[model samples]
Target: MLKASSDAEALRSFLMGYQNTSLTYQTYLKELERLVLWCAHVQKISISDITSDDITAYQQFLMLPEPKALWCGNKRSKRLKSGEVNPDWRPFASELSPTSIKKTMSILDSFFNYLVQTQYLKGNPLSVNKRRKKRTQPQTIERWLEKTEINTVLEALSEMTEPQADAFSIIRAKYIIHTLFYTGLRLSELTNHRMGDFTLIEGAWYLKVIGKGEKPRNIVVVDEYLDALTEFRKAIDCPGLPAFNEKMPLIPMQDKLNPIKQRRIDQILKWTFEAGARRYETLANQEIEEGPKHLRRASKLRKASAHWLRHSYGTYLVKSGCPIEKVKTLMGHSDISTTMIYVHIATNDLLDSAQGLSLQEED
Candidate 1:
């Protein structure tokens, strides 16, 4: 139903014409718009004429600039100092990170493929092979919160007084934190959940997640999660609700009937930090620290983010003697090779492989 004024707009229109109900479609449209702008700035060509090299050139352009310098806020809004925000503040170039770049590339590639299908273009130029840099092999760096620090975060939550220390608010913070660490669901995935997505079947709980591509996958829930769910339900008066009401959000916003969004999540995180949970307060400000290498205190703030929990689950699976193939299935990885990264992190079974190495420098 959308109209196009330019080649990029036309392409976006074509994309919109397809199955376009999902959030990913909007993401694709934004990426395409950015790509079109980048192409316009650099090559000064219409989208129909862009070659694969233009795409590669734009990728190179992206890595040169540092990221933006928004102050990563603390509980008291303290400005923790860091390096300059990226100098390349251009609209298309400034917003791109490695992950975002990858996403953009994928969206454009798909768009181009659509052009091919429609016979608007003869061939796809972005199909050309390019060698990506091989970064150094990763070494296992300890990144999880210590048991004592977990206690510290909890104790800080417990120590809140008066108006700031509402029991439901405190419970919400603890559950959200614990759920992320224990379940390893992505932030969007967790927040997007509805009450109907969870079911208790024969005393076992399961999460019916609408993951990438809107594919439904059922994740098994353990006892701890069951307890959390039970507690949350009791707090929210779950028994009174209609069983099949798709409108009910699993985690509703505080004092509202609607589902909690990312803004609420951010507020909860800020509240956690303000309650003397100093380490947790730093989650928003995490970046690659440049310095002489030494073992630094593990930042619970960094470790407690949504993806860290996923990483923890993968790493723990590897460490706990689960086969890589099984772990891949549990993690819902589409590619076995993609799942192999966790294999390297699992230390116990790889001792024999490690024994084969000999490091004698030539004299």
Candidate 2:
């Protein structure tokens, strides 16, 4: 019943359906390409010919891709250039972690389901009952910045002098940091937003964003975020508040025409965090006795990324007595279980209560 004559043609047809969302399209393409290559070379079978046993073998293969010389390469090495495949490019950079293996299986499950739905496959090879019964491990969110650390980064951004960073750049960095912390938006959601997405409904402001899975949700805009927005707009020569249904990008580049890319956002956050780390390093040098403590703090800050701000937003909300349901809504999480992790993180102090209760704890 398969429509396509070749596996490559069928994959192209399947991928075409995801073209509307560039990120999803790229991710599916990458994962599927690896599967297709594995089938053609290793399994010596086409994608449609893959069976349940083959899927099980593929799962093992993902853990440690064999023939490392042919299947692994330097991370982010170019796979293609000027419309030609790069000979040195490999399917994987190295072995996948347990978490990564689970993710790959999930993607493959979805891919097989899609093919089944389209009649490209007689049945999904990943539909084994054991796989269906596998429970997803609870998500552990360990990466996030503390309130004081966030303030330190902001202070560092404020301290940048001319020739180091321009006035516009400093303001923009502050706005970006504040927005991420306050709104809890994913990187893609933030970059995809337009000025019109921020709307005043019944005398209150809200930002509408299309989150993961293309689901749209509205997030309340706090006063602090509004102030940051005002500063950023003023720096770009826009009104203090955006016009109704404004067509401008929420965060634009220096050109003020094109929306800022995710890479630029990463760079801005990295610079601010590194600047904050350098401040800690300076303090460590001045106070030799506290050097180790300060360096540890510096290391944490250096490891923080844009996603940390989002995690921080959720954690702070849960700590501040916001209802878990409300936090779930604000975060645009499809499942309340995902929001519950924040509660676990916020109440981690409870561990200290049990520490002192042991019968023979202190000798």
- Each prediction's whole-model lDDT (CA): 0.62, 0.84
The alpha-carbon deviation from the true structure for residue 168 of candidate 2, after best TM-score superposition, in angstroms, is 2.6
Instruction: Give per-residue CA lDDT, model 2, range 168-208, as digits (tens).
Output: 88888888899899999988787888888999999999999
lDDT of each residue in 135-218, candidate 1, tens digit only: 645434344443455555666787676676777888778777666655656666777788777676786667777765566677
Residue 95: error of model 1 in Å? 6.6
C-alpha root-mean-square deviation, each candidate: 8.1, 3.9
| Model 2 residue 344 lDDT score | 63
TM-score of each: 0.70, 0.82
